[model samples]
Target: MALALAAPLAACGGGSDDSGADQESIGLLLPENKAGRYEAFDRRIISSRLSTLCLECKLEYRNAGARSDIQKRQFEALVNKGVKVIILDPVDAHAARSWVDAAAEKGVQVIAYDRLAEGDVAAYVSYDNEKIGRLQGKGILDALGSRAATADVVMLNGSPTDPNAPSFKKGAHEVLDGKVHKIVYEQDIPGWTEAEARKKMAEAIKDLGAAGFEAVYSANDGMAGGAAEALKSAGLKNVPLGGQDAELPALQRLVSGAQTFTIYKQVRPEAETAAEIAFRLLRGKSIKSLTPETADSKSKTGIPARLFNAQIVTKDNMEDTVIRDGVAPANWICTKELAAACKSLGLN
Candidate 1:
């Protein structure tokens, strides 16, 4: 894919650190705080690692709160602030092309973080999103076991504006298209917000009836919470639920049998790697050395990318995955209500 109209301005962004400036400023703009991971994981890990690696580096961070306009302004602000590099997780992938262009015009190199921004960027760091979807599909099937051919499922996907959402949907469909009994309902969450998902789930319940679907394939933990709420309101039980991100709530739910499974995409490495790349960009080092793999964006192909693997987390292996890996705290996962479940899973 060709980059945006501003592709030619890529040279404007940064220069060599010959002087070894005492304080190099870099911007980290996350998509939103709705999923919890962006704040609790991405921002925290990225900032910490950047600070650890470059003691004199200043990290400017912002969250878009699920608004495209806010993200645009934040990007512009980061650019105007004279930051050397900007790591952006766009709220709206298509709309972000202009932001990338703007940054490039200011000589600020952009790193597409988590979500693919539809413009030329220095690098991208994220999980294999399609694999996330495939894992989710397989999780659903594993939960259904031999009854997969007779199970009905509803797909609650992420926002249509997110480029990763389509990749996730495509992969899920690859594994689930003909395997399940029926896909009773499927809709993209407008903003990937839990509230939007809750509203959609309510609609699905009304349209598909309480017992119409046997499982729900929620794109992430936030939507899984929303789906769980709708299911509870309708008095459904043991309905398989699939989620990603492995958020605390999702892990809790997984142990409590409220969620069937979740995908854990080790965020520490992803964040630390992005931080390293930002420092490298500031120092005029080759980003391709760290991210040898490449991915295609709407406006660019052969974009340097570092994609990580994801693991499926279920109640059966919650301890081995989340707890053992230190992804989630035992106290966080083993709540009073979930104590028994946690103990059974050897989480405690």
Candidate 2:
């Protein structure tokens, strides 16, 4: 819970501060604790890689708990500790602009992790937002099979507060707009929680009825599972659902025929990329190659960004994608209950 603290990164490899001292402490700020991947897999991979790259470089980890004010305080805490660099996933992107400016004023490099901040970040690392949505939208059509043309789909979007959520929605709409016959219901769930998604989906189920909806477009795997739950509660069957993030439970649901598809964004490489960029910046090295293009937020213009592609993973290709990439273990996904399901779907 306390961010799985480890030895300084400089201990594994030779590293020093800008003044050529031995110790190089880097602060890492993760956005929230709601999603399990942030705390466990992402943090672990990033911390280990940073340590390996900058031996004796300390990684101070803190969680923002999805509050902008809390994240601001945590950023100050890291700054007060005299860290050379801070990698942060902003809880609120627009609101966190001031923090980035503050860190810059104090001569600390800020690497915007996962989510892009409003101001000019030192370096940004995340998957292609629009592409992620495109993959999710295409997944829905593919899962619908012959019904792709006629399926009535419902969109369960994420919070309006999160910038990434809208970006994802835009991407999905790109592939789906004007293609499907009818959009029976479209609602953006406020909290981005499974419970809220389920409640809203239940209402959709009520408004549109079982026969009316052929598919549901849930933004992430968590909400995808929620939509599927609502469908099952309504005693429905064969409804194609779309999601991303390749979560363990959602992947299992895929194998068991409870869900349709989820996108697999390679995390280790993404995190490692961010870590390497952060260290390179701390050493006052140029990172022009790392950036692909310039992205504009509400407040800032032409912010440098490093964007990666996302892969689509359906039930048929889970083994070859998420499992093969070591995002999740085989034992965790292909369980006893999903044994026959796995074999049926060619997952094993």
Candidate 3:
């Protein structure tokens, strides 16, 4: 997760004693790159927006690669480098409390991004995760149709360390507990690793006899890919599967009938919002207008937050959702193997 550091900012003009007299620095620390969006979208958008917002401000970025230790070191590095504003998507939200506390002691402001980190954070920006889970649950139900009442579902939840994971699981359970026959088996995959998800799914298939569950509800698209492989290898076909994060592969899967649905949370606005807030904080301006809602973490209450809504993406709505938003273009999604599927879905 170590990246070559960007060139140092130019020395302040007029040799001012105050470091903020001319050049300012803002840090963006993301949780991991495995999800693809962090490097492909969030980092690029946030960096571009920050440059546009402040010409003299420098952006220092890092990705933890799902390692909390690396993240803690990165956070400390930013603080020691005199970065006053930091946008942090923690690898382990709970472990971030001490980091936030240390940053606060150094007069630093931490804006929790995507994942809500514990401790006294200045702000948080993410999708309504619980509602996202509800959408996921509903997607499974819709795919199941009449069989939903008798369906036993296998739930492949996200990392135990991520704060958002519990909320997603809670929201999904609220919708799925009574609607489906029962949750036949559920496991929280650590670090949100696709390989672990695949291993767990294989174990589920072995124990459940391949026919015990009627559907698979994966917390995100990456894990869905793993579960899909396990299902395919076990020759379990036609069982409904759903996930969040309308990633390109997941969209293609939807077209090929490998995955039933995915939740699309527009990441551009989310990244831009974080950049705007960071710029405001750098200028000592108010972020009240940007954050209209409040959220609670384990260590803090009434923390200002901006939560975006998510949409369920299916083969039927490809044109209206991810395609309309320009998240993934038609050409990018429709490969030679999937050309027919794309045409039949009106994606061409």
Candidate 4:
């Protein structure tokens, strides 16, 4: 279970002593790269913010590649390396209890990032996951319009191991249960794999026929891409599809009418918040100011937490949200094939 570590990011310029005794190390362990946000936004933002916060601090980062065993090993390695604070977005939130407990035994602090990890964590940073789900359900309703009254829907949920997945599903059901005609098919995808999503979506189409479902609710953008491909292969047209994480391709799909909408949880602020908390914790400062709210996991209660809000992104508000915030720049989403869609949306 030994992980191949990436080189630690050393902060540039000097404000504090650069000697080994004066240096501080913080570890960031993210769950997976399939969603792209971890590597694309979270890692960079957290690293930069930490550099700004502590000029002599070193950031050690590791990605589990969606394997809990790998993440467990990485966590152990960081603790062994004397990293006093670790920001962990667990690949399997349930499996994190022992790891977090072991870290605590060694006097290490754990900050649950994005997804809540079980055990005694110093702080938690993430979005209102259930609200994201409600917005996703609303996206489907909005796309369905008049047809929502009798429309059949398919639900493609996220990983069962991810703690946030259930909240997302619960929120979506709250919004869609009585309002929609029926939920014809539902599957909880493991690891949020796009291929698994595609296979399940194809299976649903096979069992229910091409016209069986009127819309699809993918838990995140990565799965939405798979669902889109399956829909296209089945020759299913204009079946409203919604997903979370307004990723670049998802935003492109939104403009092209392939995806109805996506949930954009501003990642920079979330990453920065985690970074700031880690810095404060390293400096022995109280984080009560940063964490105004509280969260509870199965193993622990009343944990200090900071939850950000999410927005539903569609073709109409592309400019106002993701583009304006620079989460996904206009040029990044406005590729050559999507130029017409971009121009029509005034993005070009």
lDDT string, candidate 2, 170-207, tens digits: 99888888778777899987757899899999999898
Rank candidates by TM-score, best first: 4, 3, 1, 2
lDDT of 1 at 214: 85
For candidate 2, the 10 contiguous residues with the lowest summed lDDT are 13-22
- Please give the CA lDDT of all the candidate structures: 0.82, 0.79, 0.87, 0.88
lDDT string, candidate 4, 136-183, tens digits: 999999999999989999999999999999999999999999899999
Write candidate 1's Cα lDDT for 1-348 as tens digits.
011111212212223332332237788888877677776677767767776777667777788888889888877766766777988888898999977976777678899989989887889998889988898899999999888898888999988899999889988988998999999999999887788888888999999888788889999899999989888888888999999988989988888888999998888788889989999999998877789799999798998899999999888877787777676868877888878877787777
Which regions in candidate 1 have their CA more than 4 angstroms from the true location? 1-23
| Candidate 2 overall lDDT versus native | 0.79
Model 3 clash pairs are: none
lDDT of 1: 0.82
Give the per-residue lDDT of model 3 (tens digit) for 1-348.
Answer: 012112222321112122332228888899888887888788877877777787777777888888999989988877877889999999999999999988888789999999999988999999889999899999999999999999999999999999999889998998998999999899999988789999999999999997889999999999999999999999988889999999889999999999999999989889999999999998999999999999999898999999999989999999988887677888889999999999888897
- Can you tell me which runs of candidate 3 are displaced by over 4 Å? 1-23
lDDT of 3: 0.87
Clashes of 2: 12
- Model 3 Cα shift for residue 92 (angstroms): 0.5
